[model samples]
Target: MLKIYKTKLDEEKKLLEDELGTLGQVDKKGDWEATPDDKMVTQEVQDEGDMADRSEDYEERSIKLNFLELRLADINRALEKMNGGNYGICEVCKKKIEMDRLEVNPAARTCKEHMDKVV
Candidate 1:
């Protein structure tokens, strides 16, 4: 069961990274930043306006990238816990997390009872 969850989490992480890379680039500190490609630039005033429009698009992408990055971090943390023999244990209650809950979100840090306390 843990192996299945890990596999799914790993797949999701890769997809998120791929999606993020398409709309942005990873910075030196491992943060994703949305940026327009050079091809968006052209030799015309209207092209300059297009650049501005692209900037707005990049901003939206940045917001989405940030969300996905946070999820990826959570997934990675769960994977790390599995390696340390702590998989499926709720952080708040230290109880075995429900399999159903784990199925829904393998990265969850708390059981259903402490769901509100999850960081």
Candidate 2:
């Protein structure tokens, strides 16, 4: 039953890691730090418009990195639960999570009833 979920989780983890690698660098603590997409910000003589574009690109990359990191965390947690024999169990209600919800998100930590209430 968990084989499919495990496979999906592994695939997603790889893809997210790859995407995150392009957008940022992983710190020594294993946390991803967002970096500017435009590597041409080296010289100190940048114009206002150029600086603005670089700043905007960095903000975009930061936002994307954050989202991807969150998803990766969820996938890791789900995989851990699977290893612990607790996968598909809602963290909130402790009920069996719906298959439909699992289908939609293999990393889901809650059932459809408590999806929005999850922290």
Best by TM-score: 2
TM-score, every prediction: 0.86, 0.93
Q: Considering summed lDDT, which 10 consecutive residues are worst modelled in model 2?
A: 36-45
Q: Which prediction has the highest lDDT against the true structure?
A: 2
- Candidate 1 stretches with Cα past 4 Å from truth are 39-49
Per-model lDDT = 0.85, 0.90
Q: What is the per-residue lDDT of model 1 for residues 2-119, given as tens digits with 9 covering 90 to 100?
A: 7899999899889988998887888899888887655566553366777777777777888888898889889999989989999889998899889899999989888999999976
Enumerate clash totals for all models, in the order shown: 0, 0
For model 1, the run of ten residues with the poorest summed lDDT: 37-46
